[model samples]
Target: MEKAWWKESVIYQIYPRSFNDSNGDGIGDLKGITQKLDYLKDLGIDVIWLSPVYKSPNDDNGYDISDYQDIMDEFGTMQDWEELLHEVHQRGMKLIMDLVVNHSSDEHAWFVESKTSKDNPYRDYYIWRPGKEGGEPNNWESVFSGSAWQYDEATDEYYLHLFSKKQPDLNWENEKLRDEVYKMMTWWLDKGIDGFRMDVINFISKVPGLPDAPNPEGKKYASGGQFFINGPRMHEFLQEMNQQVLSKYDIITVGEMPGASVDDAKLYTGHDRDELNMVFTFEHMDLDSGPNGKWDLKELNLLDLKENISKWQNGLNGVGWNSLYLNNHDQPRMVSRFGNDKEYRAESAKMLATFLHMLQGTPYVYQGEEIGMTNVRFDSIDEYKDIEILNMYNEKVIQGNEDPAKVMQSIYVKGRDNARTPFQWDDSENAGFTTGEPWIKVNPNYKEINAKQAVNDPNSIYHYYKRIIALRKEHDIMVYGDYELISPEHESIFAYTRTYGSEKLIVITNFSSEHVPFTLPENLKLTSSELLISNYNVDKNEDVSSFTLKPYEARVYIGK
Candidate 1:
C-alpha cells in the first residue's frame, strides 16, 4: 500500500456542542474551538474531525443536518467557522468536517418542500411509499426505536427513516437527489475544507423493493439491517461519489459504517477501489454487547476483543485500511467501559491509549479522552439529556413499567450521554466549560480529572497521549508495519508485534488489575532491546524478558 498523511495522522474527534462554550448560552461553539486550537496542537493532534456543526434542530444532536451548507445557530456563524478553519490551517493542522448525507432534519427546506404534496417537484427527493395492508409500507424499525416509516397526512404515504422520524431517509435512487448531494459536497470542498467523515455511508443504497425484514422472534418491528447494511449499490454509489467530488482534491475520507463486513470493507477501502480511504468499522466496538444489542450489556471477554481486532488488522493488512477508536460522542467513556475508572484510572487510561495507538491504522481520540475522563452516573433518568437514552427510558420504565433502576444502570454503562458531558477544562462550576447552565450536566468528578490538573501534573494521561502520538511520528513501523498477534489465546494480556523491515515493535498491555507475567516467544529475542514507552516506571537495567507486569501496565520495546 501507499503512505498517506491520514494513514500516519492521529485524528481528534470533537463533539461541538459539548466541547467548549464561548457564549453564556451554555452551548459549545465554533469560537470556543478556535480558542482551544493551541491546546489541541500541544497534544500533537494532526487532524481535527469536528462533529456536525451544520444547521440542525438538535434531533440526534447534529447528526440530523438541517442544511448542507450553513452553520448551526447554537454552534456559531459561518464567519466563526471560517476563522476556525483558517486558524487550524495556520497552526499547520487539518480540519475534516462531518458529512451527514444519510439523512436530513425534517425541518430542512428540501424535506419541508418534499413533504407538502405528492405533485410537488421535490416529492421524489425522499423515499415515500404507499401503505400496504392498512399498515406501514414495510416492517423496518427505526434505529432510534419506532417504525422506520412515518405517515404523512398530506400525501397519504409513508416515508422511510432508518433513524429518528425527524430524520427522513433521502432517496438515493433519485438522480436529481444524488446530483444535489454531489453539488453540496463540491460546494464544501471548494470552500477549502480538508475532507469528510461520511455518516452511515453504507446505508444510503438500501436493498431493492425495501423488502420486509425477517423476524424469527416475531416482534412488531425487528432490525432490517439485512436489507440496508452494505446494500447492493453501496459500492457503485461510493465510487460515483469518489469520481464526482473526492478525487478532485488531495484529501482524506473515512466512512462510518456499522454492519460492514471485513470483505465488504476490502472493496470500500482498497487502494485501487477509488472509494473511501478507510472505514470506521463497529465490529470491535460491539464486543461488549449481548445478543440483545447495545442496551443489553455483558462482560467483555478479552479473548473476544483480541480475536475481533486481530481479524481486522490482518484482514485489511494489504488490501484496505481501518479507523481505530474506542469511544466517541455516541459511546460511553472507554476508561469507564473498558478500563478501571476507579483505582488505576490514569494507568488504565494510558494502557488503553498505548494499546490502540500501537495498532496499524489511524487512531481517533474522542474529546476529553486524552485527560482520563469517565462516565457520569446521574441521580435519575430525568437528569439525562440524550434522546436515545431518554427514549429507551420512556419505553422500558415509564411506558413498559420496567424497573427504573435497571434502566438507569444500563444508561450509566452504555448511554451516549456519558461521553456528551461537557469537557472538564478545570475544577470550576461547570468544569470551566461554560459560564451559564450547560445544555447537559458536567461530570461530577471534574475536580479530580479535569484538564487543568492533568496539564499541571507531569504524569497525567494527557501528557501520556502527547508522548504516544509523538512516538508514532518518530517510528514508521507504528503506522505501516505488519501486525502479528502473540499468544492469541491469552485472556488478560494483549500482546502484538509490528515488524517494519528489520525492526520489530513489541507491545504488551494488561487489561486487568491482577499482575500478569509476560515472556517473549521462543523465536524472538531482544538482543538490542530498547524500552520505548510504558504506563509503569521501570529501571533501565531491569530485565524485561519473563517479567511480571503490574496492574493496568503497558509497555513498548523495540528491537533490531
Candidate 2:
C-alpha cells in the first residue's frame, strides 16, 4: 500500500460548540479551541477534524451553512479562526474543517435569492420543484422529521431539504453551483486549512425526476435515501471535485457517507478514484439498531460487529482505506453504547481503543473520548439540545405512536445529544467547559472523568490512547498491514491480526463484561511473541495460549 501522512496520523474530532468556552459565553469558539491546542498536542493529536463553526442560525448547530466564507458570530470571528489555525500549525497539528456543502441555511443569501421568485437566478442553485397534487413534490422524509420538501410562498414552489426545513439541499446537478462549491473549497485550502470532513457528502447527488419513496411503515414521512444515496452522478461529481479542487492540494479528505455500501465505499475511497482519502461508513455503528431503526434500540450484537468490521477490513483491503472510529459528535459515547460504562468504563475504553488502533486504518479520537466520557441521560426531553432527537420524540411520542417514557429511554440510549454535552475538563460547576451556563448540561460524572485527572493518572484511558497512537507511528504495520480476523465466530471476543512483511500483530478484545476463554489457533504460535500493550498488563513470562480473558480486557501481541 502507498504511504500517506493521513494514513499514519491520528485525527481527533472536536465539536467546537462543546469543547471549551474561553470567553465564558456559554459556547465554545475558535479562541476556546486555540486555548486548548496544547491539551490536544499533549494527547498526541496529529490532525484535528473540527466540526462546523460557520455562520448559521444554529438550526442544526453549524451544519446549516449561512455564509460559506464567514465564521459564525457565536464562534468568534475570522481573525480568531486564523489564530486557531496558527496555534494548531505551531503545535505541528493539521486542522480540517467540517465541509457541509450538501445543504445551506435558509437564511443564506443564495437561499434567500432562490426563494424570492421562480425565475430567480439562484433558484436553480437549490433543489426546487412545484408541489404535486396539492402536496409535497414527493413523499420524501426529512432525516429530522416530517416532509423533506418545504413550501416557499414567494416562489410558489417547494425546496428539498433532507434534514431540517431551514437546511435546503443544494442543486449539485447545476454546473454553476458545483463550480461555486469547488471555488469555496479552494478558498479554504488556500487559507492554510488542512482539508475537510465532508458532511453527508454522498447525499449531494439525487436520482433524476422527483420520486416517491417506498412507504413500508405506512408512516407520514418516507425515507428516500434509496434514490439519492450514491446516485448515478456521485462518482462523476466526486471525480470532478477531486480534479478541480482536492487533487491540487496535498490534504486529507474524508466523506461521511450514510447508507453507503462496501462497494460504494470502495469507489469513494479508492486511491485510483481520486475521490477521498477515506469514508466513514456506519454499518458497524448500526449493529444495535433494531428493525424499526435507530430509536428501536437493542443489545449490540458482537457477532454482527465482528462481521461488519471484518467485511470492511477485508473488502477494502487493497481497494480503499478505512476510517476507524467508535464514537463521534453524532453518536452516543462508545463506553456507554458498547461497554459497561459504570464498573468497567476505563478498562473497556482502553480495550476498544486498542482493538481499533491495531487495525490497518487511520483512527479518530473524538473529544472527551480519550477520558472515557459516558453518555448523558437527561431527566426530561426539554434538557436535550439535539434537533433530531427532539423531532423524533415529537413524531413518535407526542403523535401517539409510542409511549413517551419508553421513547425517552431510547433517547437516553441512542440520542445524538449524548455526545454533544460540554466537554468535561474538570469538576467545576459546568465541568470547566464554561464559567457561564453551558449551552447543554455537562455529565454529572465529570468529577471522575475529566482530562485533568486522566493526565495525572498513568493508568487512565487517556494515557492508554496516547501509548496506542505513539505505537502506530512507530509501527508501519499498524497502518499498512494486511488484516485477517482471528476467530471470526467468537461471540464475545473480537480478535484480528495485521501482517506486514515478517512482522505480525495479534489484537484480542473482550467485547463483553464476562470471562470468555480463548485458545490460540494451533497454527499460530506466540512463544517468540512479545506483549506490546494490554488493558491489564500481561506478564512477560505469561503463557502463549488457552487463557480466560477478564471483563473488557484487550491485548496486542507482536511477533515475527
Query: What TM-score would every model get versus the actual structure?
Result: 0.99, 0.99
Stretches off by above 4 angstroms in model 1 are none
lDDT of 1 by residue, 1-560 (tens): 68899899999999999999998789999999999999999999999999999999988898898898999999889999999999999999999989998789999999999999998989989999999999999899888887899999988999999999999999898889999999999999898888999999999998889999998999899899999888888999999999999999999899999999899999999999999999999988899998988999899999999999899999999889988999999899999999999999999999999999999999999999999999999997888988899888888988899988888889999999999999999998999999999999998899988999999999999999999999999999999999999988888999999999999999999999999988888877867989999998988887767788999999999998
Instruction: Compose the digit string of candidate 2's lDDT tens values, residues 1-560.
Output: 88899999999999999999999889998999998899889888899998999999999999998999999998999999999999899999999999998999999999899888888899899999999899999999988978998888877888999999999999999999999999999999999999999999999999999689998778777889998888889999999999999999999999999989899999999989889999999998889989989888898888898888889999999889999999999999998998889889999999999988988788999999999999998999999988999889888888867888899989889899999999999887898999898999899999888988999999999999989988988999899999998898889999988989998888899998899999988877854788889999677777867788999999988998
Error of 2 at 134 (Å): 1.4
Q: Rate the local accuracy (lDDT) of all candidates.
A: 0.93, 0.91
How big is the positional error of residue 233 in model 1, measured in Å on the Cα after superposition? 0.5
- In model 2, which regions exceed 4 Å deviation? none
Which candidate leads the pack in lDDT?
A: 1
Give the local distance difference test score of model 2. Answer: 0.91
